[model samples]
Target: MRLPTLASTVERRLLVNYRVDPPAISRLLPAALRPQLVAGYAVAGICLIRLGNVRPTWAPKAVGLRSENAAHRIAVEWDGPDGIQTGVYIPRRDTGSRLNTWAGGRIFPGEHHIADFQVHETGKELHVSYTTRDDATRVEIAATVDDDLHDSRLFSNLEQVSAFFRRGSAGYSATKTGHHLDGMRLDTRRWQVTACQAQRATSTFFENPDRFPPGAATFDCALLMRDIPARWHSLPAMPVETDVSGSVPSDARM
Candidate 1:
């Protein structure tokens, strides 16, 4: 299906970043896409967002939907016909709205799993938590609004990190066989992000010592944005070659 453009209010967004080993990042990326490195290490993270009043461009605002969604994303770039394309590669998507899971794969890219979410905001502080239906993924973020980055190895400062993600508005989702890149782009009039201090944060996926190893993955920085007008638009899937012979057929993967 052709991707559709969605309009909504980014009621809240928690961007928790992690710096991972280049090799670890490589294992997660699909064909053509490479981790957008900072300094030398690869970047990856969890994008937990609360979207409000979401609806199709042509639909009435009164009929919009709201949901809490999370994506495990990797900062990636690839060589395209035009030049180098920078964006994110999403491995999994979990949403509180069951409608999203139902429409996935048909109305849009297939979603990975459905999960319940809890969000609480107290002045400049916020806490968001969630777990998948099967309990495979569990995450939590307790943070306070701030203008300081406590720790980061990938970029020198917050601006450097923000600037990198600003140009990476485009994103692709991985398929089951890890061959196809389902495409999507984030549309925002402007990026207004603030630095955040993570009082405590955890993600089972990135915190796995065996997978990320010691020093391989560590907390870089956290950012928060609120009340931003944005849109989600579909893009053509990027086909990758599995070998030197030719492009891998779409249906052949899964």
Candidate 2:
């Protein structure tokens, strides 16, 4: 779905990150992309975001839509015209809004699976979960705001972690066609993240033994952002080699 520049309010966004063995990560990415490592481990994660007032740049706030969404992503680097470029490669996207599901890959930049979402947020605590229509993907996370990142093996402080993700604003998503990847860039007016302690977190994709193996991926930390204005801009699709299709799951056919 082609669209003009989109604007939205990031009501809440939670990033649950993991550090995975590079070998495991490589097997999942397409040939055009490779894992972008940090502190030697490949970074992968889930982004659970709730968007408000999502509409075309010129649309009024009242005409906007609100939706709960999630993306299973891996930090990756690829050779671009400029040089080596960094971004996150999204293998799958799920959304609670039927409009989003229908528009995905047509109006939106990526294909989205329809899912039922459950989100409960309080002053300092949060619980988010979702199950896709086909039941192939499920995620559950319970967390609370924290003052700092204390146990992350990937970074020492919050500033370091925030900067790391900020650079990865560009994202490419897998499409069913398998010929090319849809691209999008998230430009936020203010970039801010808070340290969060994940009391419990689980992702079917990251935890799948067939994909990540038992010791291949480990939970690192979580970050939270709220009430930030952001824009989503579409980019030219990146072509993919025919042989790369077999590397991703059948549902995503990257």
Candidate 3:
């Protein structure tokens, strides 16, 4: 049985975002979802996170598990029965924990691939890199905490960027079945973020030319969250509408 909620400590999270041409992002999303635009540009990114003390809400903290994870996501919105709803659509998930890979789609939300991760952190800086076991994905970033958003064309300031993401806490993940999306929501009581400057960043998923044509995507800004208490809740799955081909594109799977 799936747990109602899982509690965890957000040891670290880095959102390395990109601004992409709207049309390019549209092709990859299922028909039910449309890219959520900012300044007429679609937003996509890699979320590199490290979670500690993760366990069912009823369990003691001492039994919690820790893991390093990554997700490739796109900001999206869809027509809900109530109105327009906003969230993120995750195409792929990777983790260093075997337990996460085994329990993800079965007990939580998305299916996860096993990956190897290298991480180094200090008070002011962070460096992380990972590669999936199948060699289908790789990502790396070196960033430092900063006081202001740097060279971001999407949002005018750090506050605006932070608020934008806070509003899109719900995320849907693509499932192997392709007929529906697995959903989850992140809850944090003391929500806080700091602007970060990525001195170096790379993502094979975003950099693939076959998926994103030349000049379609560009680096934006990064945000960092550290030492936060959080909870994860599963949501009802949403049915998807696929194209007439009756199959999701291979490029959609990492």
Candidate 4:
């Protein structure tokens, strides 16, 4: 049985986002999910987060877990009971915590890979780098946080972009078991963001020729968030509608 909700303290969360070719983004998503478009392109990015005091809401913070984590996510939409739902589809997640890596998907909504991480923060500058132990995935970034949104192209302005993600509280991730996607919702008391300049960034998954041709994905923008309080709740399995256009399997597993 899934817990009602899990509470955690967000020590730090930095999102380094990119605007990729919609078709390219679509290729990466399961058939049950379609890319959530912005100005005709797909949105994808990496999230570097540190969570503290993580445990069931009914539990005490003193017994909570602290961990460093990252996720490769794509903005996506899928069929929903009310209508189409907007959220993120996470293809991969990595963490430095042993428990999360071991019991993910089995006891949690998503499965995690054990990875090493290097992080640094100074004033408004955020730098983070990580790679899976198997070396199959890599993400690195050095960005300077700012309040400018005039340079953004995906959204008309920063507020629009912030609101977009604020509403996308739901996320689907690969489960440890087979191809099943476990749903999870991040409930936060507030939604906030600050634009950033990507001094340098790289994503091997999007760079893979097997996945995307050159120019399919280009770095668009970055966002930063500091300390926040949040809760995570387990959701039911997604209702994916299958189609014949190079779609994912009817019984889609992570």
Best model per lDDT: 3
lDDT of 4 at 201: 89
* Alpha-carbon TM-score of each model against the true structure: 0.91, 0.96, 0.97, 0.92
Backbone collision count in every prediction?
A: 0, 2, 0, 4
Between candidates 2 and 4, the one scoring higher on TM-score is 2
lDDT of 2 by residue, 1-254 (tens): 44568999999999999999999998778788999888999999999999999999999999999999999999999998899999999989999999998888778698999999999999799999999998989999999999999799999999999999999999999998777899999998799999999999998888899887898999999999999999999988888775533444453453
Q: Which candidate achieves the best TM-score against the true structure?
A: 3
Report clash pairs, candidate 4: 179-253, 179-254, 180-253, 180-254
Cand. 1 TM to true fold:
0.91
Candidate 1 residue 43 C-alpha distance from true site, Å: 0.6
Looking at model 1, the pairs that clash are: none
Give the Cα lDDT of each candidate.
0.81, 0.91, 0.91, 0.81
Residue 132 of model 4 has an lDDT of 88
Q: Per-residue lDDT for 1-254 in model 1, tens only?
A: 68678899999988999888898768655567788888887888999999898888889889989889998888888988899888988877888989988876657664557998988987699899999998878999999998766677676777877888888888787676555667888899979888898988899878777566777788888988899989988889787658675545332232
- What's the C-alpha lDDT at position 34 in model 2? 94
Whichever of 1 and 3 has more lDDT, that candidate is: 3
Worst lDDT run of 10 residues, candidate 1, spans: 245-254
lDDT of 1 at 184: 82
